[model samples]
Target: MSFQRAQHLESINNNLLDIKGKIDVSFEFFPPNSEEMETTLWNSIERLTPLNPKFVSVTYGAGSGTRDRTHDVIKRIQKDTNLSTAAHLTCIDASKEELIQVAKDYWEHDVRHIVALRGDLPDNSAKPHMYASDLVTLLKSVADFDISVAAYPEVHPDARNAQADLINLKRKIDAGANRAITQFFFDVDSYLRFRDRCAAAGIEADIIPGILPVTNFNTLKRFAGLTNVHVPNWIHDSFQGLDNDPTTRNMVGASIAMDMVKVLSKEGVTDFHFYTLNRSELSYAICHMLGVRPTV
Candidate 1:
């Protein structure tokens, strides 16, 4: 999906009026652990706000460790900026009523968007649950809030297969999910195929491809291993032996991500959600290459 190979790039750009040259963009942020980190996250938000993202989200930590902090960060974003804020909520480590109250809190606080999930359990937590008291039950309980559920493009590490994962996605949408956000993938083909499968399964929602700018290839590879997201050999080759040079590694990272986004733009995708990993340079660079610019 090279830029030159795309015949519809011009027409698509003209037709998708909401896209800013490339289209709508959103960002993902995790809650801070201290005052210094808080200042940093806010600075990051301020930097990206000028881009006028469709919305910005705060991530919920595994097993709900950051629940209060996540809410604080999100409410702060909504209060301090013009950006629409979405707070992530997970079903693990809580009961149904607890989940309901969280949803209502967002509603009362003038926050209408939610990124809902059944987050993974702690490592020592021998047998984690699916929040399966009923996945449908939980999603419906939160339905009054516009929620975006997680979609595993490579299929969830734990899911039986790609098709089985789609079936679970269908269940969530049927239970009133408004959208889905996929785990980040290096291959556009993985996302494209996932999109087609979602369509065939009768699940309709904005299935936004999540992009991760390689902050630390070693760190990212470790995380991908934990979640079962594969790092293709070719992608590894792009960054091999560059661990010693942070500057060069970042440049290579930005270029590779830009290359992927350019192809996706050609495939008629206009919306993107970036996993900032609490740093802005790589994501900012990649976005610039895709025609996203901060206002003067």
Candidate 2:
């Protein structure tokens, strides 16, 4: 091989080898709707548990049925695994009395952590009776639950402006959240800048970066559009013309995630949260690349 080709290969290898020290990781999973999906969810959890995540969180949905599913899954994970588990609680359609009961039930079951969110409201629906900050306060009243709230690096779609969004996050933190897990973004620099802004605003909470490994570009574009997350033109070009090629798409997606982790870790980010989407392969591979491995 040419000397330049050898140097190029070594450079790529060194980039992965350059990440120093230990990295902490957490994962997010959504509740399953069917027996088959539940099986898949458990299988994914089983696969990732050995990596020893700091915590695993289950996402909640809008209605009673979905809420029940989230509760059931949280209880099962707490019962079955030695891992720390968190349940997602939203203040969207539920009354304060109902939410209080849910909090009490979770605390009674030894579930001590919650991801408090003001869930998405439907069009034409009345204004939410409670926001995430109110939920944080309410949860604290019931128990000293370890709470995690969402942060938007790119401002939340519904926010009046960036400063207003930052203030809202501070309110949640001031109301008693432990840390903030950001919405996933591909641009590492955006997160770094947001972190700087958080510090300037007197917010001292840990701002954990959320990493979503993309397998479906079209689906991601739609989600990004709704959430106001910017998809760079380069990402679009990378996934172009690969709709028929799942294997290659997976490879490209994994490569992108691995690179993002490397950059963020170098920038003093020790904690990462993976949105597993109920599949473990991509997250497992990325964690392995970061030297997060199972212990004997």
Candidate 3:
């Protein structure tokens, strides 16, 4: 009814229009644990691949237990899809020779991108290599692979402090990591501040914000605890009393994710990495909201 309100709404619409095709995004998926899950994983991949992601990464599990599964998934993606694939390589319970062999296997399969990580070490086990930085260096030495390392806006659980975490990230960059994908965080300010700190620390690699859509509040809280990411009380309050309502929960989750991306895009963040959890509905909806449509 008011001219001022009309102008405000117009500006918002124009901002959304401005973001169309101006953003780049990538998705992350975990290795499937079962045959049915494997079918689900490929279906999700096929659903999202048409969005033309920068690259899709398959996660490696803790220890060497999922090593073969991880490789099998990566190989299948590489063979079955047009999307560029990245394999998560960790130095958790493997020797340098074993790690190199895996890297070589990936190269032979034509997967060139490697998400280098210092994965969870076995209980009371000695460190195989020093850290992710070491893994980055080793990968570079083995081949000219495009490497990505993890960054934590809230600091890694094992780091002594935030500064130490940044230093570790710097080491990875200096050792030839091409990009840094951050751990998911709900508070956008945390990521903005971390981006500023990375710039101040002379880290020039593209640091993409990792976005996780929360379809389940309880599951999010548990994941946050494990990853050392803090979930604000307001988030819980927002989802409160919707315990048995899946439809409302998904609506609320989509709104939260869209709002976060809209704010980040306005703040000059053009790239995002979504932790898809091997599901496509939420992620596909979010990408569509951001104006990243299926290229097909």
lDDT of each: 0.79, 0.93, 0.90
TM-score against native, each model: 0.87, 0.96, 0.95
Ranking by TM-score: 2, 3, 1
Best by lDDT: 2
Poorest stretch of ten by lDDT in candidate 1: 11-20
- Model 2 residue pairs with clashes: none
lDDT of 3 by residue, 180-226 (tens): 99999989999999999999999999899999988899899889998
Highest-TM-score candidate: 2
lDDT of 2: 0.93
- What TM value does model 3 have? 0.95
Supply candidate 3's per-residue lDDT for 222.
89
| lDDT rank order | 2, 3, 1
The alpha-carbon deviation from the true structure for residue 41 of candidate 3, after best TM-score superposition, in angstroms, is 1.0
On residues 183-280, what C-alpha lDDT tens digit does candidate 2 reach at each position? 99998899999999999999999999999999999988998998999999999999999999988888889999988988887798889999999999
Candidate 3: Cα lDDT at 188: 92
Candidate 3 or 1, higher lDDT: 3
| lDDT of each residue in 1-296, candidate 1, tens digit only | 98775856765455333334766789999999989888888888888888888899998875455899998888888888899998887767777787778877888888988887777766643565654325446645655667788888898877878777888888888777788988989878989999998898887788988888885789989989987788989888888998899998899888777767767777888888999877777777767666688867
